[model samples]
Target: MTTPTLSRRLVAEGLGTLLLVATVVGSGIMADRLSADTAVSLLGNTLPTGAILVVLITILGPVSGAHFNPAVTLVFWIRRDLASREAFAYVAAQIAGGLAGTVLAHAMFELPLVQASQTVRSGAGQWLAEVVATFGLLAAILGGLKHARQAVPWLVGLYITAAYWFTASTSFANPAVAIARAASDTFAGIRPLDVPAFVLCQAGGAVLALAVMSWLLGDALRDPEVA
Candidate 1:
């Protein structure tokens, strides 16, 4: 197979992230409108976000590896699978596209285009949640690439779906997505002030996962009997 141009890969990353964030923000708006119950709204938001992830990753994976998440890109960059320059571009594209996603979602819902989230997602538990969420996300990607390349979409989608419930901050694992979400005042939004810490925790988590996966998935350990 031929290598896709950097331009093409960038487009895929942006478009996929746009769609992913749109689903996240739009579904949050819809869910909030439909129910007053937090659990019900969360469930409504979770399913579409998870479903769109699977769809976007499947369709766009071949084009850009469908990173759509800066944390994921950061991991690949750290691993040297992606160049520093390309990684920077990928992150820029993902952030821009994710912001556009919030715009699109708001426009579709007839809400204001620009917003600042009032939802206060902070504190130690929230920070820890981000770390855990990002770590799990990286683990899923690395493990999937190692053993089940074709199933990566499902792996990511299901992981996020589960993480949204299990994690305290509802698993905003992507720094780009976290930034975009800070622009929204909807259910899925996080306060702008909260973004930096979440991003930092996410980065830390990605790096830690990289360290662990490197040792775990390498030629370090294998069971001949199991094989």
Candidate 2:
């Protein structure tokens, strides 16, 4: 297999991050304006987030590999799907794109430069919830690519959607995403101070998933049983 270039991967990562954050921040502004004050309006935001995620993965999966999340990139690196250099580049691009997206969202909403969203996520249960949610997410991404290559992006989208509602943390499984959300201060954003806890849980969860996936898929990876 021919290796993808760093320049190419960086471009894909930038585009993916831009799209992800735009959809999130834009939908958030729209939802708040439309719903005013009601749980029913929240779907207006979440629906778009899921849609963008699926679209980016499908469009960019081959090029930048559609990591979109630092955790996802880290998992791939662990699994050898990505090189260390490539992984670091992708992560940097993700962070830059995320910050750009947040700034754009702030501009669109006419919010202050430093203004932040009010969304709250915390507690041990929530932290553990993030772990489970991220583990499932990483597992889905890794397993799909390894065993069920055809259904990769679609299945990942479904996993995120489900994890959002099922877990107490609502599946903000990506640190780049978590950081971007904090900027918008939308329904999706967590506070800057709260970020460490969420990121820590996410990282722990991803590491755990990596361990388990390796054990189960190691033999398959070594042998290439899929025909």
Candidate 3:
């Protein structure tokens, strides 16, 4: 098969991110509207996000490596799997897709087109959780690439599914997702003020993951996976 052009790869990244965030925001809205129980709403939010992730990654992986998350893209950039210029494009596409995803979800739900979230998701505990959550995410991707390339989608889906409950920040582990969520006032939203910190911590965690994975996998880092 011929290589996908840069434009096609960028489109895949944007589309994948759009769908992923739409699932997150859309499901959260549906769950919140349908249930009084926060736990039920969360469960509602988690499943579709995870399921869509698996689907999106599986379908778009070949096109863009399915680096729907800017954090994930950063990892590949650091590994030289992608160049600095292309990584920036990927991140820009992800961020734009994420914002559009929020708008799309709001439109579907008949909510405001643009909203600044009042949902305050901050504090050291959650910030630390973001770090851990992102770290684990990169670890999953890196490890799965090494031993189970075919299972990467499932690995990421399962990891986020579990992380949603375990981590205080619901494993937003993605800068694109986090920023997009800040545009929402729904159950899945985070305050816009909190997004920068989350993004920073996620970036830190991704870099940390690379360091640890490089050491842990030693010579195995010789072959870096696309996503």
Candidate 4:
């Protein structure tokens, strides 16, 4: 099989992020419209997001490691699995794709194309939730890839699904996603003012995961499986 070029990998990252965010934002919109109960709406939002994540990661993993998240790409860069320049490119693509996805979701639902979120996701509890959520997400990816590469997709999907329920902030766990979500005013939205805290917590979580995984898994951090 021919190895994919850098351009191809970049495209995969962008496209995967686009679809992932679309699933998240679009499902949230639909769920909010369909259910009066907040819990029911959340359940409606969670399932499709998880399922689509599994599909996207499974299909795009080989192409670009299926990062679709700036935090994940930053982790790989820290581990030296990806070069700095490439990592930056991946992050940029993810952010752009995420914005596009949020816009697309609004357009599809006939909502305004752009609107700042009024949904305030703040407080110490929510920040802690983001930290824990992101830590678990990275841990699942690294551990699954180390022990069972084939299971990484499902592991990630399930983790996010559960995290949605357990975490106060519903596990945004991703900087790019958080930024994009600030533009949305629906169920999945987070106020633009709240994004910095969430992103900071996410970054901290990624660092924690990298350190813990490096210690616990030892050489697995450097294993080709991660690549």
TM-score of each: 0.96, 0.89, 0.97, 0.97
Rank by lDDT, highest first.
3, 4, 1, 2
Candidate number with the higher lDDT (1 or 4): 4
Which segments of model 4 are wrong by more than 4 Å? 223-227
Q: Lowest-scoring 10 consecutive residues by lDDT in candidate 1?
A: 218-227
Q: Please, what are the lDDT tens digits per residue for candidate 1 over residues 1-227?
A: 67689999999999999999999999999999999999999999999999999999898888788999899888888767788999999999999999999999999999999999999999999999999999999888888887877888999999999999999999999999999999999998999999999999999999999899889999432211000
Q: Give me the runs in candidate 1 sitting further than 4 Å from their true place.
A: 219-227
Q: What is the clash count for each candidate, in the order shown?
A: 0, 1, 0, 0
**Runs in model 3 lying further than 4 Å from the true structure:** 222-225
> What is the lDDT of every predicted structure here?
0.90, 0.78, 0.92, 0.91
What's the true lDDT of residue 184 in model 3? 96
Winner of 1 and 3 under TM-score: 3
Put down candidate 4 lDDT per residue, 1-227, tens digits, no spaces.
Answer: 55678799889988998898999999999999999999999999999989999999999988788999999998988888888888999999999999999999999999999999999999999999999999999999988877888999999999999999999999999999999999999999999999999999999999999899878998756542232
lDDT accuracy of residue 24 in candidate 2: 78
Which residue window of length 10 is worst by lDDT in model 3? Answer: 218-227
Off by over 4 Å in 2: 221-227
Q: Residue 34 in candidate 1 has what lDDT? A: 97
Error of 4 at 210 (Å): 0.8
